[model samples]
Target: MSEARPYGFEVVRLARLEARLVVYDWAWARDNAERVTENWRRRVAGQPALFDGPVLLACDCAIVGEVCRLSLFETTYARFLAYRDGGSPDGHVANAFAAIVPWSADGAVLLGRMGAHTANAGQIYFPCGTPDPGDVRGESVDFSGSAGRELLEETGLDLPEDAPEDWVCLRGEGQLAFLRPVRFSDAAATLIDRMETHAIREDEPELSGIVAVRSAADIDAAMPGFVRAYLASAFDAGARARRRRT
Candidate 1:
């Protein structure tokens, strides 16, 4: 196996982001839909709670000096899933969106385990979802809104409406994780217990359980590749902070 490349991210704050559907790339979109159908037949053993709703998937991106300018437009949820499984005909499509990495003051990162009936069953990841039409205001993308809505829907932990520590975009393969931190005053155990109880009470819960990660080793094999990379970066940063304190 090849050596795993370290994930690189650009620190960008949530500001004016333009996300309007440009002219639909017909050929590209059709190819993406075909790929999605193929993959769904092979990978998905059963039906998932999916909708044919339209979403914006990145068609192009580039690092212009210090900024990463992305070109995104409308595509269906089916196409987005297909694009996620390396189905983009142009190979430029990316799963680009924001997520909330809830952290306690005591060095614990809270992650959620997907329920068996959900699309990402058994996978471990932070509370987040893909950006949809609900996240758009005029032409700008409201990543903070996307982050907060997803966190509330999944974990039921209502964060202060306007407090995100920092924003970073993790790029690898076909994924782009726009992650933001939501710090809590509660201890790890307390937060985990609360989240788990919330999940249990949910009618159609997305998460089956909550996992509290205090160290890198606590990140298990069930986590997706991008999630593991994020955890590794987070853990290393924590270690360096401890060294500074010492």
Candidate 2:
């Protein structure tokens, strides 16, 4: 297994997910409750639709062989928003979520632009959200289920059970985005059409629209740093694969 970088994004492969319940005690959120509440108030004032729902945060992460273990604890989305917007003043904890990488048959992948009503409006990335109570099973979290639900909610694509299930971990700026690549039989354009149709019917769709990404060149500033890093790495991998095939 390769080592993850300290600052910029590093793609690390994983064979399994393991999480254990931890006691809730985020000192930053406690010490700054007044400030955090004020920030959330202002945020909701701007985006009234944002939800302060249940969410999870990783207190610690460690990779052992093919296993990726995390110490997780539940928290409110409002605290998460404040922590994220405050540049993550609490260095002890970080946001860890899973999302599916929609790789199509035509060598392009799909990303969605978050709608204006969403917390991350205008951002383009794979369909994923922070793990919530629904992801919890016993003392651990079901990351695969979490990723699948997000994809279906945003893209309306129900990935087949037999699709390729390779996993990659994107680590950067205290955020861990677990990406599971699902190769779709449909071409990128065809998949986009399907997603558009789905969006047309949603009362308030999570994604404004889908974009096809062939390489890092398609990445834009709207994409989060971790997402851009994955794109760059994905593009480089594609180039290397092409070179070897020739």
Candidate 3:
């Protein structure tokens, strides 16, 4: 078996989904690291004029099944003036606009390995249930509330009433934000099933599919590199906790 790679995130159980807690790793923040830092600097630089209309946002990436795997939460701010002005005096306005990286938790139920679409056309892997809506941008003063709203808009999956309130930060670039569910309830599962069925029937009616993975080998054979890394981290964490209990 191939060794698992280390990932800078953690997943905690929630009543209806697993909440992925992100450990910010500066080293992992590749390519766009400087851009993100510069963005923060500009925000701080313009704090006086930008504070009044600042908006907060949350976003997540999720994997679904018996052991739910999800990405970390991220928080970002969007300035209203950046939208209206179109540009900043310091040339940082582009980064200033739509600063609130919307929070969302997705349940990517792996339906086994199969050829599917990719940026590199013709290249394929086990495509999971409904690809994340990519990044649905939004602006709101209430990050949590706005996150919930965005989740509904993007996936049509409403979170359980007792879901966790805190946000988990993931390490990445593009000023993107994400959150993952800590647990999955029967109702949530049912909703997902319905959504998947609807999408398959309406979009790709001829395809055969299943929800989540049936075994470790299934996961191994199906998942893409990044997804595999995430699952390995989550499984390792779970195994360590279990060993501690015993």
TM-score of each: 0.84, 0.95, 0.38
Model 2 residue 8 lDDT?
80
For candidate 1, write residues 1-246 as lDDT tens digits.
112344443333333333444445746557456677876665555755555677766766654443456666776777676666564446657778878899887878999998888778899989988788777777666776788889989988888655744665667667767778778888888888888888888888999888888888897899876777778777777798989999
**What's the number of clashes in each of the models?**
0, 0, 22
> Which 10 successive residues of model 3 have the least lDDT summed?
92-101
* Residue 218, model 1: Cα distance from true site in angstroms: 1.2
lDDT of candidates 1 onward, in order: 0.72, 0.87, 0.35
lDDT per residue (tens digit) for residues 1-246 in model 3: 123333433323322323333333222224344555555455556443332322322233343432323333233333323322322233211111111111113333332223132211222122222112233233112334445554444334465777655432222222222234334354435645654654554442212333353223335534333344445554565578879999
Best-to-worst order by TM-score is 2, 1, 3
Quote model 1's TM-score: 0.84
Off by over 4 Å in 2: 3-7
Candidate 3 segments whose C-alpha is farther than 4 A from its true place? 1-155, 172-177, 187-192, 200-211, 214-226
Q: Between the candidate structures 2 and 3, which one is better when assessed by lDDT?
A: 2
Task: After the best TM-score superposition of candidate 3, give how far the Cα of residue 26 lies from its true spot, in angstroms.
Answer: 21
Pairs clashing in candidate 2? none
